[model samples]
Target: MIYLQLFLSFFQVGLFSFGGGYAAVPLIQNQIVETHHWLELSQFADLVTIAEMTPGPIAINSATFVGQQVAGLPGAILCTLGCILPSFILVLMLSCLYMKYRSMKAMQGILAGLRPAIVAMIAGAGMSILLLALFQGALSHIRLGNFRVVECMLFLVSLFLLRRYRISPIAVIFGSGIVGTLIYTLLPV
Candidate 1:
């Protein structure tokens, strides 16, 4: 029964979440934090961090983490499969139709309209992460004022390294974790 519930919950999430992984953040927040109580807001924030830093889509990582937390490895597997089914089915169905219609002016216009929506979703996800990170004091949560300065610096540095140096994301993740751990231990909040 628990497994079934986990599968169904994630399936619903999968069915409706659009605009890819970042877009799913608000929905997951509602489902897991507000409706289901599977995790607290803080935990959801941590999950987002883990999801972002890990490989694969953010939504899948979230589902797997939540499922594992709720009911272990089997639950994680079921939830991941359930969450992915809608995308798999829809893409398979749409591939034929899309191939036919992709070049149509009206379809192109519709897709153009979707670009802003996707941007908004990505922005929302970024905001969620920023809030969570600040709240946890992980990303320069302390300052007499202008605490965001630290966050901005880190963000710029990360962006520069990623864009210019083409550093692998996995390397960044591991480096950040080690650095954050050391910071947490050495510094007193």
Candidate 2:
């Protein structure tokens, strides 16, 4: 029963998540965090972090992590399979259709129209993650003192490095970790 539930839950995630990994974050969050109540909000954030840090797609990674957390190894397998099935079928069908209709004006217009919706989904997910990180997932009742000062500074610095110097994101990620650790270590707690 648990395996079935896991499979169906993630199957829905895979079926409806149109834009990509980041765009699926909210959907994944809704299924795993809100609907199932399988994980706390903070844990979901950590799952996102782990998903991002690891290789492969975020939705798949999230399914595996959440499934494992909820119901161990079999759950992970079912969830992973569920998450992959839709995309596999979708890509195959879409590829065939796209090849056939590559020059169609309506097809191109449909594709172009989807771009902004995808961007909105990605931006919404990013903002949610940022707020979660800044407030330590306590977004319901934000107060000035609840903000993590170090995290804000780290965010600013990371943005600066990305925007100003065009540093590789990998370098920026590791650099932020090192700087964050040093700053936290030296600061009075």
Candidate 3:
């Protein structure tokens, strides 16, 4: 029953979460944390962090982690399958339609319209994560002391490296990780 629930819940996420994994964050949070109570909000945030740091899509990683926590290996497999199936099917169908309609003005216009919505969704997700990281909880519980100065600094430096110096993102990520580790170890808590 738990496995079934996991499958269905993630299936819903896969079905409705458009514009890729970042756009799926809110839906994932709602289904896994709020609706299903499979994980606490803090745990979900931690899952997102781990997911971001790891390879593969954030939504798939999240489903696997939550499923493993809830129901072990079989749960992980089922949840992952559920999360990917809809996208797989939709992409197959959309690709066929796109090939057929590739020259149509209406199709082009629709694609153009979708671009802004996808961007907005991704931006909203980024803002939510930023707020969560900065405040260390929901907005109502926000405290200045909870803000992570080192993280903000790392972000700024990483942005500078990527934009101004044109450094690879993977290098920036590894560099930030090393810097963060050194700061935590050297600074007295």
Candidate 4:
């Protein structure tokens, strides 16, 4: 029953998530954090941190992590499948339709309309994560001084390096993890 729940929850997220992995975060949070109460808000933050630090899409990572946390390896496999199934089926069907409608003006217009909606969904997901982080960091009893500043610096540095220098993501994750460990050791907690 727990495995079924994990699969269904992620299946719903996969079905409605239109703008890629980040766009699925809020929906997953709503399901796992709010609806099921399987994880606390702080745990959700940790999930996001772990997801980002690992390889793969954020949505898949979240599904696998949450499922494993809730149940075990079986839950992880089911949730991962649920997360990807919609995209697999939708893309296959759409590819066929796209090939058939290659010269159709109406189809082209529909595709154009979808672009902005997808962008909006992605933006909403990002904002949701940011709001959660800010709210938690501000309201927590053990708030760290200048934590937001550190977050902003890391975000900016990451964006700059990825966009400008095209650093490999694996390199960034491993490098940052080492740097973060060193910083934690050096800085006063």
Candidate 5:
């Protein structure tokens, strides 16, 4: 019963979560943290962090993580299959429709309309993650003075390197991890 529930919960996530993985963050949160009560907000934030750091889509990674946490290996398989099913089917169907209507003005207009919505969803997700990171996973702790100066500086420097030098994101991520580990390990945070 629990495994089935887990599958359905993530199935809902995969079905309704449009605009890719970043945009799916809130929907995934709603399913796992809010609706199902499978994980608390801080745990959800940690799961998101882990999902982002690992390979593959964030939503799929999150499904696997949550499933493993909830009901172990079998749960992971069910949840992952559930999460992937809708995307697999939808993409197959949509590819056919898209090919058939490749030059239609209506299709172009629909695509144009969707672009802003996707951008808004991604921005919203980014802001929520930023708030959680800055506040240390608790919104109640939010204050002007609570910002981690070193962490914020690290983010800024990483962004600068990526934009200015066109460094690979994977390199920036690994470099940031090493820097953060060294800093936190050496100094008292």
Candidate 6:
């Protein structure tokens, strides 16, 4: 029963989630945090961080992680399948239609309309995670004073590196992790 719930939950996420994994963040959060109460917001944010650091799409990684957290291996498999199934079917259908209507103005207009919505969704997800990281325990306790200076610095530096220097995201992630570890170890709590 729980497995079915998990499958259906992720299936819904996969079905309605347009654009890419970043766009799916809100849907994942709504299902895992608000609707199902399977994971707290902070945990979901952490999961997003981990998912971003790891290979593969954020949506798939999140479904697998949440499923494993809830019901172990089988849950992970089922949830992953559920999350992937809808996207797979949709993409197959869309690919055929897109090829047929590649030059259609209506199709181009639809894609153009989706572009901004996808950007907004991604931006919203980034802000949510930023809030979670900066205001430590904000999700669980609603505390706004517990600002993490080191994290903020890391975020700024990472942003600077990525934007100003055009460093690869993989390098930025690893560098930030190393810097964070050093800070935790060398700096007094």
TM-scores of the candidates in the order shown? 0.81, 0.93, 0.90, 0.81, 0.90, 0.92
Candidate 6 lDDT over residue span 43-128, tens digit each: 98789999888889999999999999999999999889999999999999999999999999999999999999888988987888
Please identify model 2 stretches exceeding 4 Å from their true place: 185-188
State the lDDT at 132 in candidate 5.
79
Ranking by TM-score: 2, 6, 5, 3, 1, 4
Clashing pairs in 1: none
Per-model lDDT? 0.81, 0.90, 0.89, 0.82, 0.89, 0.91
Quote model 1's TM-score: 0.81
The TM-score that candidate 5 achieves is 0.90
lDDT tens string, model 3, 70-183? 999999999999999999999999999999999999999999999999899889888888777666776458888888788888888888999999998888878988998999
Residue 56 deviation, candidate 3, in Å? 1.7
Model 6: residues >4 Å from true position, as ranges? 139-144
What does the lDDT come to for candidate 5?
0.89
Q: Write the per-residue lDDT of candidate 4 for residues 1-189, one digit (tens) a residue.
A: 888889999999999988888878889888998899999887988898799888889999999999899888998999999999999999999999999998999998998999998888889877766655544442334354534554555566776888999999778767766776777799863
Candidate 2 residue lDDT tens string, 90-118: 99999999999999999999999999999
Residues 1-189, model 1: lDDT tens digits: 989888988888898788998888888887788888989877888899889888899999999999999999998999899899999998898898889999899988988998998899889878767765644443335444534444454566676888999999678667667766776689773
RMSD of each: 3.7, 1.5, 1.8, 3.2, 1.8, 1.7
**Minimal lDDT window, size 10, model 4:** 137-146
Runs in model 3 deviating more than 4 A are none
**Per-residue error (Å), model 6, residue 143:** 5.5
